[model samples]
Target: MIELQFSPEVANARATGSPLVALESTIITHGMPYPQNVETARAVEAEIRAAGAVPATIAVIDGQILVGLTEDQLEALGQTTDVAKLSRADLAVCVASGGTGATTVAATMIVAHLAGIRVFATGGIGGVHRGWETSLDISADLLELAQTPVTVVAAGAKAILDIPATLEVLETNGVPVIAVGQDDMPAFWSRSSGLRAPLRLDTGAEIARAADTRLALGLPGGQLVANPIPEDAEIPRDVIEPVIAEALSLAQTQGVSGKDVTPFLLDRVFHATEGASLAANIALVLNNARLGAAIAIATTT
Candidate 1:
């Protein structure tokens, strides 16, 4: 049995049967610098709380899976260097080795299911990378969605990825990609990907019913709730595409691969956009957090 250490707040929430949303930790460790990382994390948790749900930020430390973290834990995690960025492939290995690791989207879903939390909020899910045909490099996040029974609320797949190919993979895997309040799937940092979503649901209640129906039907996978970034916060695709292109080229030239590719690309995009990308990222994550909280509440109702 895997050992789970739930923080006091999360333990109380669980015992009281309150709605809970699982949050991934890689955003703190791999997505940004220390003080800002912790600040953004706390803001997200506060958003969830304001929206009537508890946020459970999942991580692994000393071979134990942490369902939630305290303020001190969050601060320490944000400042800690060389933390393993864990996904399905290496989650167990890290745990077995007693390593401290930040859970990525895939790892968070796995741990959320174990913790009996059914909803998660993230900035974006990783998907088929650009040049996937040559590199055949796909993120474990896509596969995790196809198997884990946790409803994931993300802005969409990261705009840096091949959006069309990622959508195709999700369709092929029979994962429902539901765009919230829109027909066009969202592109991270932008409101539209120019690709029609396979499904559309306008409200948290509608999404909750869909998730519950899947559970009743014994469906094996979860649903992807593609929440668009707020209009005021979005960087238009036209302005961001060239920036992404430059960043992608830089990444290719640098030979950044595997797990390192995402953070590297994001960092380049951040610099290229003069930190606008990070600001947009934080906005989208908070947006997703509110929706995640609503979905968690709707699930109970």
Candidate 2:
């Protein structure tokens, strides 16, 4: 049996039956640059704690699956070069090879479930990528959500993806896509995708109860809570859509594909928006962290 390495704070939380929220580590290792990456990670954790839950930032280091990260570990991870970007496919391989890896949404959900964590917070999820009809490139995150029992709070699938198709896939998989306080599905970095949500819930308690009902019914998976970015922080759909189109055009011209697609497109979007996208990303992540904590607390009580 594989043993999970829990940080002191997370260990204490688990021991005391306190609420815990799982955080993915790719935001630190791959989502942003070093100092900012570490800083944002700390800020997100702070948000979770302030909202009344302990944050467990999941990663794999030297063959151990760390359910939570210590401060030193978080800093080191942010600065580490050549860290493998792990997902469901590569996670076990990374651990078996004694390699360090940063967990993506799918890997984080898997780890969170293993750690008995019921909720995870992330900036956004991977979904059906554009040109998927040709490339057939879909994220393992969708499948993870269909099988793992940990509820995930994300702004939505990244706006760069085929949002409608992503929603369709989730529906086909029987995963609940719950929009928080809105009828419109949120796009990452933007408050509205313009697509109506399949399910809508107004509060953390509502979302938690839905998740519990699914488990009670022996449903295979968890719910996707599509929380919108704070209004002040959102880029506005009209503003971001054109920027995303230009970025997608550039990606096509450059032949970026597979696992490299998202980071490449995000980099282009970041530059095109003059770093506004990153700022919005940070905002949304913090927002999601707060909601995740709320859901965690709700699940326990």
TM-score, predicted candidate 1 vs. hidden true structure: 0.99
Once model 1 is optimally superposed onto the true structure by TM-score, how far is the C-alpha of residue 75 displaced, in angstroms? 0.8
**TM-scores, in order shown?**
0.99, 0.99
Pick out the ten consecutive residues of candidate 2 with the lowest summed lDDT: 292-301
Q: Candidate 1 on 1-301: residue-level lDDT in tens?
A: 8879999999999999999999999999999997999999999999999999999999998788999999989999999999999999999999999999999999999999999999999999999999999999999999999999999999999999999999999988989999999999999999998889889999999999999999999999899999999999999899999999998898889899987888889998999889999999999999999999999999952
TM-score of 2: 0.99
Report the lDDT tens digits of candidate 2 across residue range 124-198: 999999999999999999999999998999999999999999999999999999999999999999889999999
RMSD of 1: 0.8
Q: What is the lDDT of candidate 1?
A: 0.95
